[model samples]
Target: VDQGHEVHVAYQTSGNIAVHDWDALRYAEFMLEFSEQHGDISEVEQKLYRKVIKFLRNKKSSDADLPEVRSIKGLIRRGEARAGARFTGLDDNHIHFLDMPFYETGRTRKKPLGEADIQVVADLMQKVKPHQVYAAGDLADPHGTHRVCLDAIFGAYKWLEKESWIKDCWLWLYRGAWHEWAIHEIEMAVPMSPQQLRRKRQAIFMHQSQKDRPPFPGSDNREFWQRAEDRNRDTANTYRALGLAEYEAMEAFVRWKG
Candidate 1:
């Protein structure tokens, strides 16, 4: 609306909490511990049900002391439930959330990408007829979900092309938390002013469940906000090094040929 353009976001996954194997295990463990203490397995479900509520009430639990569970499937389900609640709570009047399947698999293995997943995306593309589409570029993400998501988008685009319903859309790939596009590989670098940077940080802050200490911070100990700021600033610096105008922050993207 601000730029006289429609903005729509499609999340392949609801960002079901910690998708890494280790993180999943940690979450499972925590739930198991809660079950054990309450002397009933049902309590585990109850606890997760209240997680978003507790967070909203400013009584979120610290991640450091959570126990680790061995059940991956159980954890995946719990994560999806938690993610749904979190997303619903954070819903804004301007943004619409599409109902996509939550393939609740983590680092252990890849969820078999299927036509259904591709079709969902294809339908969205046909409906939106967007001039641009962005897919995750972190093909080597240790957790694997990013790569899966990218493949799904590719599949959707291919399907649309086959049906002759494809629009003249430009596809862009963006890396996730694990990595950023190399300076030489960047095709588009968007500069962010100080106020824009602050606004971006505030938008990120809305995902309160992911703040403080996320379950899987990876090798980088910094919080998500810190990591994002550093990456954006680094991209800006890299652009400056190449004799571009200095910017407070920058987000780089690579144009995808496919």
Candidate 2:
């Protein structure tokens, strides 16, 4: 928003577990508490505990009345509201938000990429008529949401093309948080100074729910901010290694072929 460019963010999933309240360590503690009280659990209570544990472990439970899902949604809403507040002083007219209906964790995965999903994005593209579109680069995302999001964006672009609505809009794919783009795959590299990096980190911190310990850290135990900084710095280092001008940090993106 500070760059005087119109920015539209479409969150494909709620990212429920991306908050500080639902970390793996806390889940493990809950499991231990359940185990200690297992003997006193009635048949109905046992089933409830099992369901909770399964959800915590990133597994889908048969029971639909799980409180965890609701809690996740609440966390997501608050985080989004906080994010919006951070940009209140900026040019709100240049910022837009589009949230798609999708699950946060892998437990309640949504349906496969479909026409409706594609159409929604295609309509947005047609309306915006943007010069560029940045889609998610599904890199090492275990839950497959990123891949599905990419597919939806691709489908949307294809739909727009068939309708002759896609003009000269270019698509850029970015990967971060979970993984970074490979050195060979980076087409456009954006250099960031120390102040820029710090500002970026501050923006990330607005999602207070995702600050200290996110629910799904995957195999990487580092916090999301740390992971982001490390990935960006590494990309900058790779660029320098290739004889590019040294930068304090860099964000790499790969242009989508299709």
Candidate 3:
């Protein structure tokens, strides 16, 4: 389970615009519960949203392109990531929200990899010097964040290697929540029990803002976790259909780029 060794996850983006308005609204409400260590600050956060709701109430007409502030959007996604990590048995301290510099601007449009992003990753890698480093390897990521993230990680790894800090680290690649490693290609498959499947779904729920809103703007209409779990379950089923033992769910991985 790699429990004793520190495992660090640097999810690169907030995945805010992946769902719809109604879903975003509801998710924002649920997220209010976990916004702080104290829990359930609906009075205060909802008060903030009320200002927006009130503002939207007056808009009989508005700029088609202009939308709500990105800070609100980023807020929901961060809460979702927090919830997802909790569902996966990830300790809050071990999970990091790099929320990479390039993703700070809400839109998918991004600038090239810069020192800001490289330094954040480099600092984390050096700080953790983890026994294992796992990252999203969805070369097919609808957005190029995965590609850019991989580039930054590889760049950091190269720096670490030269610094003599990461030669002993085990590297692993995880497909985005969108995709999974092919049956024949998986190097490591973490099987999930029925309970874990539910937990994964729960984690996906943490990203509620993406569930029904402009969420991650994916190819499918299904919520992110729905798509993720179905794909995960299906991957496991595919394995079983191909004559492997059945499992409730499976998050598969492959070898590192190096």
Strongest candidate by TM-score: 3
Query: Which prediction has the highest lDDT against the true structure?
Result: 3
TM-score of every prediction relative to native: 0.69, 0.73, 0.76
- TM-score of model 1 (CA atoms): 0.69
Give Cα distance to truth, residue 49, candidate 2, Å.
21
How many clashes in each structure?
3, 2, 12
1-258 per-residue lDDT for model 3 (tens digits): 235655556766555444344444554454544564466566767677565555434433332212453555566667777777776767888777776777665456777888778878888888877777887788877778789988988888877787665877767888755667767788899888998778667766776555564435558677666777787888788888888898988888898758
Number of clashing residue pairs, candidate 2: 2
TM-score result, candidate 2? 0.73
Ranking by lDDT: 3, 2, 1
Per-residue lDDT over 1-258 for candidate 1, one digit per residue giving the tens place of the 0 to 100 score: 335665565656645445433445445456657777887767557676355334333423433212222234344544444454344343233243343453544233445777777778777788877788877787766566677778888888887785543556889987656678888899998898998788767766665546677665667778878878988998999889889899999988999887
Candidate 2: tens digits of C-alpha lDDT, residues 1-258: 566766665555556544432443364356557766676556775565556556656644353424554554454655554575454434444344444445432354566667766776777778878888887795578677788778888888877776554657889988778788878788998999998898878877777666666656678888778989999999999889988899999988899878
